[model samples]
Target: MSGTAELAIDAAFAARLFDELAARTGDAPGITRAAYGEGEQIAHDMMIREAQALGLTHRIDPAGNLYLTYEGRDPALKPWVVGSHLDSVPHGGNFDGAAGVIAGLCAVRALIEAGLRPRRSITVMAIRAEESNWFPLSYLGSRAALGLLPAESLSTPRSDTGLSLRAHMSRLGLDPARVGVGQVHLDPAELHGFIELHIEQGPVLEAAQVPVGFVTGIAGSFRYRAARILGEWGHSGAVPRGHRHDAVFALADLITALDRLWGEVLEGGESATITFGEIGTDPALHGFSKVPGEAGFCLDVRSPSPACLERIHAGLLHIVAGIEAARGVRFNLGARSGSAPARLDEALRARLAAVAEGCGAGFTELASGAGHDTAVFANAGVPAALVFLRNQNGSHNPDEAMEMADFAVGADILARLLARDDND
Candidate 1:
């Protein structure tokens, strides 16, 4: 272990805490800590206990974000915050959200053990409701913390229990109305920078044999919720190929066109990804004997470059138009949900790179395919960055392998970065 790791991170403690939380929340498939549910609440309570044990003062923000604060020499200075969420997707791995929070806590623990005080406070926060699986929202806690999400989003009904997020909060004894408006607990202006350490959640680092990686930016994405194709219902066998306006066939053509568009996007030397996560015909109208009258699907497109995203989107629209004319079907690409790309602070990246080098930790720079809470802060002009720890078996599933050594190295890097008073 390097000086930072030795002084700042308690690797054993972090590992133990991870195991304890996993055991408490683990189920047959994987860990289950639904947002605002029993598991999430238990995880939060455990975090509070740990913070108290470390002699740190903790508070719950109006948005239900838990912040454990290690006071610094100047309490009024904007805090350098580091943390990740505690809630998990259904059947998610133990380390997905938990590792980041534990890493932040361990980093702070190391600093306290070393009896070091920086110019600004360091806060470790375990954010809530990062996974959209529970509710129809992503980054709810972070966005609400920043006052970026609308108040109406709080009242949006969850898919599982058919209760609004507000109702769920009420069940947890939190005021939903108060939670929607951010800045009640901590001002966004009071944040110096944000650092989130998360499992790679992909095979990139493992394949490259790197222990850690720095995120360049978060991918911007476009989502179509009700993309549909309308055609006349007819017999599957009796309808002639030329006479039938088959919706399913039109959907297939659209997918093929999108794939061609994807090829063109690659030819332009821009990275882009498109997914048709859902495709279905109306069950009442769709049968083995009938030609499908209507089809519905969801399209998700993402890219690190806004230009590339728009380029692909334009291609999609063009394909829809062409398909509609060729197949005699009406294509309805419904309302889109869009988020612009967020680039990490270059200065902060430089600092992290230097710190990682000093710690002798092997690292590489990459852009995150998945979105994170860091993007919300970074988009709002805050200095925000992500550090990805190596993991196997991917994330949002069981058997997510995050070795303690790798976890310690990541914590060491973050601790050293936070320990710096160079800019202050």
Candidate 2:
């Protein structure tokens, strides 16, 4: 087969692998490849098998990240890493994390078939535990691999299994002691660059009729994981209009105020989003006859602009204070998890754009509202960027969909990008 034909065949094979992995891990609901669990481990083994089939060497880092290496002319030079995570949220769609890794695999295969050697090694990495659904944490693998995770977080227990992250890693034969100690971390200075290919997980690309998008930046976000409001319980029917302090009412008022604040922020020519995903009243303390005495809720606010996030957060604080006084309730909101926005490396972005144009593919520039492993690497001082393939039905569900043609286009771009020399 000609080199171009061989590359095309590999790209098709990568797309098929997505179907096989998804079928193996999940069925009716969606993908259930939880981090350090049986399903995820199965997926990782498949990745390693594919790497070996392609004549690449594979190894697992201390944080449980998998790296498949293609040797270059100079072994000592830093590697150009291309990959994404293999784990998924419960019932999440197949393409969320797996597409990038598959694309990297195809890209490396294409380079090998063409018999091209660059100055630095090329590695296809399968990062671990990127979804926050299972562990109440995002970027678990990438952060630990970069030594950016807080040392104390290793022993923190998870909500689902009551097992700390360290325990989970130990169960999987990864040493927790090596995490954050520079022993398991990928040094920033030792990386030539990083690129990740992913499904858009939103409507932007599909709406624009574009096959791919060059990400300008990833949004920063703040989470109020365990926010509580306290008020005195009272008889629901007997209390006068001004006599009772209802925690549920207070929470309603706060939500309304935040909605209005969101509009104000949008009017100010900045992009931002806020979500109150979970809320509830204490089950044991309340009934239909009594006013709710305590309420708990979670909040998530995101923006590509740091200034916009600050402004929206300030508005939230002001709204909380007003609601507390007006409704006679106490508010206790604490920080849970957050990371700042990450801008893509400009030089690498230009190369991706050029490759897309050369392939005669339609493209656009956009900002990713959802966070990805690329942002983590970018924030850690590695030159990083992301390419988003058009996807529909959003993500984190069984209905998520993307065209195989789009996937092939993205894989081609990645192949061309990886094969290019810096001076070329």
Best TM-score goes to which candidate? Answer: 2
Cα lDDT tens digits for candidate 1, 1-424: 2234447577889988998988999876888998988889999999999999999999886668899999988898889989999998888899998888999888888888887777789999899899876775667888877777778788777767888998988888787777666444556677899999999988999999989999999998888867889999988788899998889989999898898888888888888788898899987767888989899998888899998998888888888888888889998887777677889998899899998888778999998988788888898778898999999889988889988999998998888887777756
- Candidate 2 — what's its lDDT? 0.86
- What TM-score fits each model? 0.93, 0.95
Full-model lDDT, candidate 1: 0.86
Looking at model 1, report the run of 10 residues with the lowest lDDT sum.
Answer: 1-10
Residue pairs in steric clash, candidate 1?
A: 8-110, 234-291
Off by over 4 Å in 2: 1-6, 180-184
Q: What TM-score does model 2 achieve against the real structure?
A: 0.95
Off by over 4 Å in 1: 1-8, 181-184, 282-285
